[model samples]
Target chain A: MAATRALGPAPSKTPDKPTDAAGQAPRRRPRAWRWADIAEFAGSAASALLLTWLIFDRFLPFRIQGVAFFVAWYALTLPIYWLVVRDGHGPVAARDRLASVLVTTGAAVALSPIFLVVGYVTYRGWSVIDFGFLAETMELTGPLSGADDGGLLHSLIGTLEQLGIATLIAVPLGVLTAVYLSEISGPLARPTRLVADAMTALPSIVAGLFVYSIVVIRTGWGFSGFAGSLALTILMLPTVTIAAEQVLRVVPGSLREAALALGSPYWRSVLLVVLPTARAGLATAVILGMARVVGETAPVLLTVGGTNILNVNPFSDYQDNIPLFVFNQIRSSKESFVDRAWGGALLLLALVLVLFVLARLAGGAGPGRRSRRKKGAAK
Target chain B: MTTQESEAPVTGQPVGGTLRGVGVSAWFGARKVLEGVDIDMRAGVVTALIGPSGCGKSTFLRILNRMHELVPIATLGGSVLLDGDDIYGTALPITEVRRRIGMVFQKPNPFPAMTIGDNVMAGLRLTGRKTANREQLIEESLRRAGLWNEVRNRLGAPAGGLSGGQQQRLCIARSLAVRPDVLLMDEPCSALDPTSTRRIEETILELKDQLTIVIVTHNMQQAQRVSEHCAFFLAAEDEPGRVVEQGETEHIFGSPEDPRTADYVNGRFG
Candidate 1:
């Protein structure tokens, strides 16, 4: 066996091992520091410092002024850090957050101009918003000597009358047309929908011209509140129809099935279930339609000629709306007339605000009553 | 079975109110959905209709109550009889037929805007039943549906606020409030979880005493569990659906005469 031993035979003795590693763990290389993180921190700190300096101190002469400016500036900066810097650490970097913040802040700043304009209006208009200013009519046409001689009671009444008639004409017709479009299915429905879409884009001035041509030029009728209402109806119909249709379509199909399964007729289902479900949205639609045509000056100017005195009758003769009254006041050479115009503008704004509040209250009351009734029945 | 037979004669008329179909076919414009089908529904028992999707099980269910009449293009052949009376006869009113035969859909479709109590009272009010005892009827209906205790204090709250099971129970309560002779349920438990499905099955078993029930379901176990009579509808080669076999639930599940029925019941195929 000794003579026949192989050249590469295995060693019988155990190999020597290192003696320095008695129950100790191996060492690891230190991790490389991330420069990007440090760069981001420095960048944020620098931006914050710059914003603080620009806002707190007068570092830039053209910088925004006062607490309003500081509030707005901080409001703009907080979102930038929250949205942009926090998400900017990924592998594929993008400026989406930054762009969003910039767009939103830019829009806020752009719309801020309206606040100043309204502030100026309120400051000037408050002096003329007294009870006497609302109680009397703006029939007087004298110079700037009489301070308590004029008010906008008549013009306010005329505006209400015209808008009310317009709503009466437009809302039912508009809502019915929308219902027909949504529920009735046939070849005729397509053309009807197309006509509604086309009508939606019809210009307010064109609507005025349409009414003027038909009622005034062709029928030999004089400019009156009725004609003005017809013109306003033309402006309001498409708005109501489109909005009501959208609200009606949003009503769940399940509600319809629930009604139909009860063996109720189609009209009964629509009247009871469908209408009640969409009542809140329908009210909103009506308010929006009223708001749209309430401020029309061209139609009123073309159809209902402006008057110095108020005319309550909508049929016989010309009547003055708030817009027409304001136009007449502004065109007059007298300073009192100009002051009355400002007052009338303020009054119109107040009327619209009141209408919006009432609409909101009406909408809120329905759901409240419904929930209360449900609770009563539950018990 | 003896109790059902005895009770059927005491409720207004005798002979256990029968609904029969004879060589009935239906078409949706050019498409032939159901072809030459015949079935008989007996009062006071649960009849299960099992089929795959688009096999016209729902169409057959709808035909019983004349719900298909609402569709402009849907056409029908032959006749459906209720108590040996032709339902499609010119003398009978569709509204009256629907009022007598109430339907519950697959989804738990309680009117979201209405309160639980109002939903239960909907069908009653629609039929001009404005009696002074409406409150009692509403309470009784909800209690019978096993939903009164949970929704007793919130009758005025919107039905939509209830959980899925509660809403399904509420829908059942609504159906029962009308006192219909027959209840047509189209996959009522298909949208429900197992626990909800169990509760609805218990409700169905309880309701079988007062009304005839026809249920359309895809779950074989559910059909076996809840139904007394079972009808298996299978898709044909050229046509869509026809009844393959029907009998007592025990025979259908345990020892069906037809090989196809055995295969389906044993889970070899649907």
Candidate 2:
């Protein structure tokens, strides 16, 4: 009763101060793009560029240009922009705007390399790339042959075969290890997790050397695509395991308790309820693992003996993949060889993109998302 | 005991099973929470365990269905009996005991990945129980939980899309689909609004004849409204929780044997 007495009545919808006859306060309209903001930005940027040009051409003894000029202009733009914003929106808003500008600049700087690499690869390789180039192989083409004479078909096949084998070997083992760590958590969990974490930092070249020494030399497997896949699997496992463990750990404990309360055994609860709920995240983990090993050139170079001729069978003779192809061809003095290497690099980028899209499509809708397939209906 | 006092039979199916917690005590690691709590939750009736926060009410509720042992350090010191059989004994497997005695938690936890119909039938698949008529069982369970009409059209929709109250009811339906003889609800309606709470109360009243229910609640009015037998739990400073009083709801509320019970029921002190 004392608690209820201290509470008091609910507040009125409108404030007690001034209001219109309808008991409504004045509305503050939301504007996504204000003309004043745009003007201030344009004015500050133009003045900064002008100041940078004057400093380089007239004020300074040296005429530094190119990237340095733009860098200087960017350096000057911040303070100018801050001052202009301050004139319009006061100091506090100007500070907030400056912080957002810095964040955007940081993001742009971080993203520049991806854009530059993809753009340069496309520009250099687009001339030699066509359906014929994709369909044909380097088996018939000589060192003096033109860029159009050979294609990446052999290397493409080798890369796909090796990646598929590696994924098949690694994903199950990694996911199971993750499940054991998160759900079962026995005495070995600590040591297992420690080993997995340590292996994540293991150099790709070391993985290649280990697999080469064991499979290629010890077992006399030679340098086959299978040897290359074994190397890739060693690199891929820890990545998948660590990422998958993190994902599985975040699944709400309530779901586990709910499953247990329903008379579901421990293993059944993990298999049916926990794993299915974390499906999307596990797919992402697998993709991250694949991405880490796909462009690994040193490992494939050491494990997979580079071959010009197409070799579809991974367990037999030497095979060629995209990274190895790019590495070998780029070293040649011929313009055609260099062009083909760029084309291979571009194709590799496109392949990774395609794999991401395919994995996303196959992983299906995440938990709580509308699947629209009607396949989840009860029996 | 309340179990012997209520022996009237008015149902078609094999109705509520008597659940008794005999001298139940619980500990998390070394710290004891509940000590020697014995209560007779009579068949075909709802027994409400009311107590202040941190009084081990929820722990006792979890103990009934063996969910208390899920915690790594949680330890139990007594036996829970369902239908005259010791649930803690070697006679029945842990999974079988849980299947016969189901539970609903305070927060609604419908599987987000599952559809409404699938969530209801999840228990059967989880426990590996095969039913000949799955659709009929789902419908019957939903009807019993009073959530059939609201979700019948969207059975294929994700269970997570439902409102909080509806999700709680769906959890209830999921628990009911296994056809458990006893249902333990741990403050099932504490997170819901007044109307949803009232609807769940009505569902509880309707379900009393089919299976035994033991609910732990903090609200005295809810305890009085939903349960026939009431047990008040209390824990003094530096002591483990124990039952202060246990009797019919009317007698416990109107004329209790303990002054603490009266003070608690009257909102004077907890």
True contacts kept of each: 0.32, 0.69
Model 1 misplaced stretches (Cα beyond 4 Å): A1-98, A109-126, A145-149, A213-221, A354-368, A371-379, B1-16, B69-73, B236-239
**Which residue window of length 10 is worst by lDDT in model 1 chain B?**
B1-10
Q: What digit string (tens of lDDT, one per residue) describes model 1 on residues A1-379?
A: 1122233312222124332568343332233223443355456545765777665567655665577666655555555455445577542333543454467668878988888766766766677778888778767645754545778777788899999999999999988887887665556878877887788778778888888899977898888889999999988898898888888899887677666777776777777788778888888889988988887898888888877677889886878889888888788787777777777777777777777886786566554376786558999
Top-TM-score candidate index: 2
Rate residue B20 of model 2 by lDDT.
Answer: 91
**Chain A TM-score for each candidate, in the given order?**
0.72, 0.86
Per residue, candidate 1 scores C-alpha lDDT tens digits across B151-235 of: 8888877787888988998998898787777888999988999988997887788677677888999999999999999888887
Quote the lDDT for A254 in model 2.
94
Could you give candidate 2's per-residue lDDT for residues B1-270 as a string of tens digits? 123212323346558789999999999999999999999988989999998999999999999989989899999998989888999999979998898888999999999888899899999999988999988888878888888889889887889889988999999999989888899999999999998998788888878988999999988899999999999999999899999999999999999999999999999987
TM-score of each: 0.79, 0.90
lDDT of 1: 0.77
Q: CAPRI verdict on model 2?
A: medium
Q: Candidate 2 at residue A264, lDDT? A: 95
